[model samples]
Every structure is written in C-alpha cells, then in structure tokens.
Target: MKNAKSMSRHRVAIIAGLLLLPGFAFAQQSITVTSWGGAIAAAQQKAMQDPFTAKTGIKVIPEDYDGGLAEIQSQVKTGNVKWDVVNVEAFDALKGCDEGLFEKIGFSKLPPGDDGVPASKDFAKGLMSECGVPTDLYANVLAYDKAKFGANGPKTINDFFDLGKYPGKRALRKAPGVALEWALMADGVAPADLYKTLATPAGLDRAFKKLDTIKPQLVWWTAGAQPPQLLASGEVVMTSVYNGRIYDANVKDKRNFAIVWDGQVQIPEGWVVLKNGKKTAAALDFVRFATGTQPLAAQANIIPYAPPRTSALNNVTGATKSSLPNAGQSGRAVVSNAEFWSDNGDDINKRFSAWLAK
Candidate 1:
C-alpha cells in the first residue's frame, strides 16, 4: 500500500509538469522596441504601440537611439539584449542581417493586406529582405526657408551647389550617404549612373571635390530635428532634411518652409528583430501588426512619410499627399542604392569623417 501511494504521487507530479508546458509557451507579457526619437516616435506611439497593446495585452516599452549599428551590435555581442525590435534603414537592415545581428524574418508568417494581397506581393518591389519588413518610405530632400529665397528659391539640383547664385550657409547632414550622391548629381552625374559613378575611386574623389566648393559655407547637421531648427534660427538658409520633419515644421509649427523635390534620395525604413532576443515571438507579432496596412497608413496620416505597402498608400489622402517625397519629384529623384551602401558604408564614413575634420 505504501509503494502504491509513492507511485501515485510520482504520477501526479508528472501530470502537473505537463499541465504547465502550455503556460510556459504562452507566457510572453511584454517587449521592448527602439527607434529614432522625436516626432517619428510620437507617431509610432499613437499608430502602432497603443493599438497593439489594446489588441494583444502585451506592453511595449519604447526606447530611442541615434541611428547606427553600435548599440545593437553591443547588445547582440554581449548577449544582454534589451531591445526586441528596432526600426532600421534599408542599408543597416541588409548589413545587420548579413552579419547575423538580426533574426531571419519569415514573410510567410505575416498576415495578408486588407485588400487580400499576400505580404510578399503587397510590399513595394525590391524592399522585402531576409531579416526585415519595409514599413515606410522617406527622403533626404533639399528644404529651404521660403522667406529666404522668396519665389526665386533654389530650383534645381545644380542650384543647391551654386553658392554664387543663392549664397548663404547651407546645412548638409554630416554623413556621406546622401551627401556624396547629391554632390555627384550636382556635378552633373546622371541619376541612372549615380551608383556606378560612386563605385569608382575617381568618381568618389569627384563627389568630394564638388563638396569642397560648399565646404567653407556649409553648416553640418547631425540630427533630423536640427535642420528645421537651423532654418528657424536663420543659421542656415537651406538644408537637406527628412521630408516629414520639414512638412511638420510648415503644417504643424507654422514655419514657412518649402521642399525642393529635385534629387530627393528616397529610402525605405523597416522593422528588424534582434537576434536571440528573449521575446522573439512577441517582437515579431508587434512588427507584423505595426507594418500592416492600417498601421502604416495611420503613421502617414500623422506625418508625410509614404507607406511602403501598396494597400496602405491607398489609405493616405488629403493634405498629407502634398508633403510626400514623391510630390513634385518629377523624374529627378534617386532611389537610394541600399546594396552599395551596405557594402561600402563603413569605408566611406571613415573617409567622410577624415575630410570633415580637415
């Protein structure tokens, strides 16, 4: 009888262990997401995170960072990752995936669009990648204080470089990514040949040489928020700025600013999951919901960055349409070459830094 009792207790213990398995599998409660802060973060908070929490019962902890791979790399290398999901630019997504810093995203798992199109087909062409899902489209655009140039403001790509024509301090982002492309274009490199030209040594020098013309009069900006501020303070007459920021300055803050759509360098931004994050399942669910048609469109309503989803773009209408990167872009825009930047960013950034210091 004692032996029989012992066996029954052991069986009961085994049964209890089996009962807890499902709880363990479904226990995810919260996740952390990181992105570039400021208006973009506020827009995401309203459009994505708040709704996701209401739907999933999973709390999202938001964090901000200046754009780069350093923080993610340290978290991944140290195995103490705090961020489950991060918003990354296209080149960073490609480089991070290639370096195994981010989890491989399975597009098949994402829900179809509201229009019933598959996620794979619904996203814009050449944007789907192995480890990230494209969320929105933005551009580095030439924006100026309309009051500074009046109606005769800098019109063409050439005019941005023509100090003698529209002479004043011009603010350029201190990065080589768009600056080099703009330099080459200002020097008359055709849009179709931009990447090919930037690929060679002589072409690289040519871009830097062109930049040298405006170097004396150039005021460098490092943050997205700074350009609008610079223009407001009259520190610079014109600056290359993110489309959304300048748009907000005009429509929201009532600053008199205008975008010169010529030579806009448009690029896609996406959501990426950190490799080996503790909340991988929850992180991916958040990414799916955040990149969905409604969420992408919702963000565009708050800011002018275009949605990358075909279905989501349909939802964007009214005043936001006039602020988009594609507005008045004509045929003079360059879609950023993500692969070229992914491969060469580090080397070019180093050269750019050395030049900046001199």
Candidate 2:
C-alpha cells in the first residue's frame, strides 16, 4: 500500500508539471522592448508592436536607450534584465554576442526574406549576426539644401571633399564609423578594400589626412536632427545626414533637401535578446513578428529607413520609399562591416578623438 501511494503521488506531480508547461507561454502578458526614441519608436509602436499585441495578445512596453551595451552588461551582471529585447547598432550586436551578454540567435528559425530565398540569403550582407535579427536599414548619405545648390549640388562623395569646387562648410556626424569610410572612399580607396586597408596604420592615417584637408570647412554634428536643422538655417551647406532625416525634412517639414545616394554607407540596425531574461521566449517571438516582411515594409512608410527583408521592399510603395539603401544601391553603397568595427572601433575612436582634439 505504501509503494502504491508513493507511485500515485509521483504521477500527480508529473501531471501538474505538464499542465503548467503549456500555460507558461501565456503567463507573461506583456514585454518591454527598448529602442532608439522619437520617430523610430512611434513607427515601431504603430507598425510592429501594436499589431503584435492584436495578434498574440502580448502587450509590448516600449522604452528608449542611447546606443550602447553598458547598461545591458550591468543588467546581466546583476541578474536583473529589464529589457526583454533591445534594438542595437550592428557593432553593438556583434560585440555583445561575442562577450556572451546576448543570447545566440537561431537563424534557422527566422522566416525567409522572400519565399524563394532563405533568411540568411535575403538580408543584405553584414546585416545578419549570431546574436540579433536585422530590423531596419538606413544609410549615412549626404543631403544638401536644394534651395542653395539646386541643379549643381555636390553629387558624389568625391564632390563632398572637393572644397575648391563646391566650396562651403560641410557637416559630418561626430563619429568615426561612416565618416572614416567616406574619407577613404573620397580619397580613392576602392569600396571592396575599405576594411582591409583600414586595418593598417597607413590606411588610418590616410583617412585622417583626407579629413584634415577639409577640417576648417567641417561642421561636426553629434545628433541626427542637427544636420537638417543646421542646413535649413544656413549653418552648414551640405551635411552628412541620415537618409530618414532628409526624407522627413523634405516630405514632412517641407524643407528643400535632396539626398545624394551616391557613395552612401549603409548601416543595418538589429534587434537582440539579452540572456537569462524571464521574457526571453516571448521576446524572441516579438522579434520574429516585428522583423516580418509586411511589418518591416509598414515601418518604411512611417520612416524611410529601408526594410531588411527583400520581400518587405516589395510591399513598400512610392518612389521615395522605394529608393532606400539596399543591396543594389547603384554601386556606391558600402555595407558597414560589423566584425571589423567590433574589433577595431574603440582604438580607432581613440585615435580619431585625439586627432579632433589637436
């Protein structure tokens, strides 16, 4: 009788555990997603997150953070991760994964970018990573006030550095990422050898030397919005601006701005899940949903940053949205090399900073 009672109790416990396993997914009714603030967040809310809730009944709590992994590192160290999923730059996603602070993604689970192509084949090169899903695409492109130059605007990256020809104060974002790439390209560095050459000290010096040629004419901008505002007010003539900012300026604000897609450096933002978060499973589901073809395309309508999915691009309408940075970007687009930047960015930024101080 004792043996039978013990066996019966074990069976009851197993049944209870089995029942709870199915309920576990539905237990968390909400998840917090962190992203860059302003228009990007608004678009995600309308296009992705809201639709996700309506379909899965999982509430999405949206939050904003400046791009970096320091806070995430702290969260993981303290075992108190508040963000289920974070939208990070390519290098951040790469570095965070290398450090094991983020969960290693299972790329096989992601839906195809197009029906005929696998997920791995669909994304533009360097967009996919072991730890993150590529979300939206953007470019560091030059935009000029159409009122100022109109027909004779600086048309190429080479033209941007040609101070004697298109003489004026030009603005660049205060970072070594795209600016250095542009510097090398403007100095006749072939697009294919950008990172290979940048690996050498001679190449680094060459980029800085190219930058030095226009130091006096440079207006350094830290924020994305500053370039367009500065351009409208005549503070800078042609500014290195995000394509979306230029899109907003022309379509929404009625500012006379035109983007020079030539020599544009494309950067893809990623969505990452932190390790050991309670909501990790749900977060993965949300990322899978948010990065789908239609959802990504919907985001393009709200903001001009291209969708990473090739199928998503098919859903985008209008000439403005159609021309977003992509794989076939007219031979002038350089996809940012996340691995190289992850390896060398800190040291490069230090050198770039010292040069700026001097």
Candidate 3:
C-alpha cells in the first residue's frame, strides 16, 4: 500500500509540471501595452492584440495616455514600471533608450517577414533601433473640413499659413517639433534644409516670425484626437493632425475631413519594452508578433499610417492606401529627423513654452 501511494504521488507531480509548461501556462500570462488611444487603440486591438491572444493565449491589457515621457520616467525612477510595452514616438524611443529607461531589444529574435525575407532587410532603413522597432510611419499633416473648404480648398503647405487665402482660425499641436518645421517651410525654407536652417539663430527667428503672423488665429491643440474635433466643430478652419486621426474621423465617423499631404511630416512609431517589467518575456513575445509583417499590414488597412516594413506595405490593400502619407506627392513629405530632435528637443521646447506665454 505504501509503494502504490508513492507511485500515485509521483504521477500527480509530473502532471502538475506538464500543466505549468508554456503551452498550458500561457493563458495565465498578461502584459499591459500603452498607446495613444481612440482609433489607434481600436486598430491595435483588431489587428494585433486579439490575434496575438488567440495564437499565444497571452492576454494584452491596453492603456491610454497622451504622449510624453513623464509617466515612463516616474515609473522607471521608482522601480514600479507598470507598462510592459509602450507605443513610442521616434524621438522618445531614442531619448528613452539613451536614458536607459527601456529594454535593449534583440532585433535578431524578430521573425522573418511573411515573404521570407530577413527582418533586417524587410524593414525600412534607419527604422529599427536598439531598443525599439518601428511598426508604422505616421504623418502630421494638414487637415480641413471639406465642407468648410469647399471645392477650391487650401491646397499647398503654404496655404495653411495664408490667412488671407484660407482665412480662419487654424489649429496646431502646442509642441514645437512639427509646428516649427511647418513654420520654416511656410517661410520658404526648403524641405531638405529645414532642420539645418532651424538649427541656426536666424532660421529660428524666421520660423517664429512666420508663426507670429498666425499667432492670433492659431488655436493650440495638445492631443492627437483634438485636431479632428476642432475641425468638425468649425472651431478652426484648418489644423495639423496625425493622418490616422483624420482618416478615422472621415472613414469611421463619416465626417468630411480632407488631408493635405504636402509637407506632411512622417514619423516612425513603434513598441518599446519597458525595463524591469514583471512580464518581460510576454512583452517581448507580443512585440515580435505585433510588429510582424502581417500584423503591421493588417493595422494599415484600418488606419492610414503606412507600415515601416516593405513586405507589410505590399500586403496592404483597399481604400486606406489613398490616404497614406507616403502615397501622395513624395517630394513634399518630410521624414522627421529623430536624431536632431533627440539632441535639441529640450532647448526648443523651453523656447516654445516661453513663446506660448507671450
């Protein structure tokens, strides 16, 4: 009777070990991913999160935030990081990585594209970083309500600054990044020489002087979702917006917003795994899956942001293509220089705040 009892106990222990294996234990794992919410969150849920859960049995808990590094900084400084993976702008990705606030991702671990090409070759050049991998290219472009603009609406990038021609209150994000670039371009700085000129005192003065022309008419917006709302309510005639938000407003909400792609500032956005998260393994797994070619392409169909992977772009189809920032006049679109921002952001942001106070 003692021998039989021992054998049964041994068998029960083996069964428990098997149950704890990855395949069976995956359902118990969950990771939190933070993003700029609304349409982007909804798109992520449909394209990546849901499918990832189904395939790996790992749950993704989504959270929303207005863009910034303060929350991440607080979490990391206190050793209480709650976000496992975060959707970061290119500048933050570089900045956070420099500050050692994020995990150093092993790009080699990412799988090959669905087309069988290696990930290194499949993704766009300069998009993959040591700590983050870009999922898509989003643009801050000019958008206007079609009904307000009528048939002969604001056409050129310069028109966004032409109060007499387009004539009404205009909206721009309160940040200096894209707004400064737009101001420089409107002041006749060439797209290729924008950052170069903006680095100079005279150039900074020129850009600000241009902005001053519209200062009284400028309505400042701080959130990604505000541009569309500002336009829809006739609060502003034209506003600089994330292309995805304008797309969602028009397609999903049946609003008549139109995007002016000329001089659009394209920025790479992607996932960064926070350092010291409890769910590091699950977070890395989800990043690999979500940034894959198919998932990126799947997201593009829902939101207008173009996938950073060539393979993913090839896979994207449907009406969303027309609204893609890269699909328009290529010469006019400016890919933001992340390095420049990483180096100069603090100084410029302080100056911008001073200008805002004035």
Give per-model CA RMSD. 4.6, 5.9, 2.6
**Model 1 alpha-carbon drift over 4 Å, by segment:** 1-28
TM, every model: 0.91, 0.86, 0.94
Residues 200-240, candidate 3: write the lDDT tens digits.
99988888898999999999998888999999899999999
Per-model CA lDDT versus the true structure: 0.89, 0.85, 0.90
Kindly state the number of residue pairs that clash in model 3.
Answer: 0
Q: Which of the predicted structures, 1 or 3, would earn the higher TM-score when compared with the native?
A: 3
In terms of lDDT, model 1 sits at: 0.89
Instruction: Rank all candidate structures by their lDDT, best first, as comma-separated numbers.
Output: 3, 1, 2
| Residue 211 lDDT (model 3) | 92
Candidate 2 lDDT, tens digit per residue, 1-358?
9999999999999877865886444544799999977667887899999999888878899988767788999998899999999999899899999889898875687877646677777776657889989888788998898899879998889988998998889999888998899999998899899998899999999999999999999999876668889999998889898888877777779888988888898888889999979988789889888888878888887887888777887788865566577635654778888889999988998998998999
Leading candidate by TM-score: 3
* Best candidate (score: lDDT): 3
Among residues 3 or more apart in sequence or in different chains, the pairs in candidate 3 whose N, CA or C atoms overlap within 3 Å are: none
